[model samples]
Target: MGHQYGKKGEELVFWNSQKQAVVSNWIDVEDHKFEPPALELISELLTKPRNGLAPDLAVVAKAEAQLAKVLDVYEARLAEFKYLAADNYTIADVLHLPNLQALMETPAKKLIESRARVSAWCSEILARPAWAKVVEMKLKAHA
Candidate 1:
């Protein structure tokens, strides 16, 4: 599946005995095509400085600017629709679950929380019982 659909395939897939694989690749492409740049920017902002050197404030600012632009795009779309693709939940929203969960604990949390609709969407998704079980399992495993 990964070879066939790349990272999007690796993210989420539904397969049945009929050999049909319902994939999220198209939704991923349409919804997240502009995300790599924001991801790269976040990576640059979060990576530690090496060799006892100080973090570059200028570079961090640039990355924040880039991320802000990406967030603006998301905010606009989310204002109109409850989810990325439509009003209903789908693989498109599911694909973002983990990343958004992680970001909630990071410096970039505001990227999601600052937008009203995006924040509401995240709250609704994160409140699901399945996600709560996943978090519980992760905590128990670490303990």
Candidate 2:
């Protein structure tokens, strides 16, 4: 992932101004609208080592277990309710999809596949035109 502290993603995904002295002086620290999702993702991906492609087996198992707890929470909530936070998409969905897909490659896949709404949520995100395009490009690039 190589997502070090200073780097630029595409304009839409990040605003990496490098925090140069001049640029830092000109920007208002509190005037930001959205903190970049790609920055967050990059941080997460970098922290995990190898974009988490080589996660420790125990770590993956533990994460799967931790996420099972979350899925249970969401599933229980959805048994009588609907989506997480809102019924429509938001930045959370965008941030989460990559991880969910990654986890789906591990033990969490069984849990996600078995959960009805979670499965539907995964399907919805993966099915979107833009999201699919991004996935296709990332996959084609083998990132």
Candidate 3:
């Protein structure tokens, strides 16, 4: 794949040049400000447990605390708007889908479910066809 790009067909180099085109369409770094914290929550709660072991209880507890804080903010906004970034679905909502889906497998999901607004937001976004397709693709990949 690297060779397909040219002499120095490094995947990183190729990705660096093309990623902006794709990412710009999905997220506007200036406007959709929720991505960073959302990403942090995912990293702390989801990715950190991928070391072939269950998540550390202390770590999960701390992440859940952080998640509650994050949800508090979203919960307030969700009362007025339909999505995290705005009234319409945006990258801010999309960013949470996969990690939230993964979280559904864990006991920590109660952090989301306990918040009415946040739970509604999750239900709406997770029900999208695009997200469903992503889940399908992931299942097929594992299969």
Candidate 4:
């Protein structure tokens, strides 16, 4: 990636060293935004209605069971949790951790524990520097 200046004091990504042909021009800066909302919302939603139905279980058991199967894809991925493309940490860990903890700490214990790889992966990622950064941030706030 390259950038060319147009007599102005702004940096732009230049494409093939030509004018207005930027492959990737970006303003680098700090972000004042919260966590990316969509991923955060899924993690939050996964926490509710363990059977994956609406808050009202008034629906039939078969309906609830069908909804619960939505987790199978994730559970299958847990079989490859050891290969999440990060050595021992990743943004995936951040996205999944909260909801995972909620599951493990609830009646869903056996369901979660049935997969050993998931447990190990979660523990390993939680022990990494990336996750530790969040822990430190929380500690500082409480202190």
Candidate closest to the true structure, highest lDDT: 3
Q: After superposition, how far is residue 75 of candidate 4 from its true place, in Å?
A: 3.6
Candidate with better lDDT, 1 vs 2: 1
Which lDDT values do the candidates have, in the order given?
0.61, 0.50, 0.63, 0.41
Using TM-score as the measure, what is the rank order of every candidate, best first? 3, 1, 2, 4
Q: Given candidate 4, what's the lDDT at residue 83?
A: 27
lDDT of 4 by residue, 49-140 (tens): 55574432333233324323433433565565452322333233445555444444443334345556655665665666755787788779
Off by over 4 Å in 3: 1-54
Clashing pairs in 2: none
Flag the better candidate by lDDT, 1 or 4.
1
Count of backbone clashes, every candidate in sequence = 0, 0, 0, 1
Decoy 3 TM-score against native: 0.65
What's the TM-score of each model vs. the native?
Answer: 0.63, 0.54, 0.65, 0.40
Stretches > 4 Å off in candidate 2: 1-57, 80-82
Clashing pairs in 1: none
Best candidate, TM-score: 3
* Candidate 4 stretches greater than 4 Å from native: 1-71, 84-90, 102-104
Model 1 regions more than 4 Å off: 1-26, 29-60
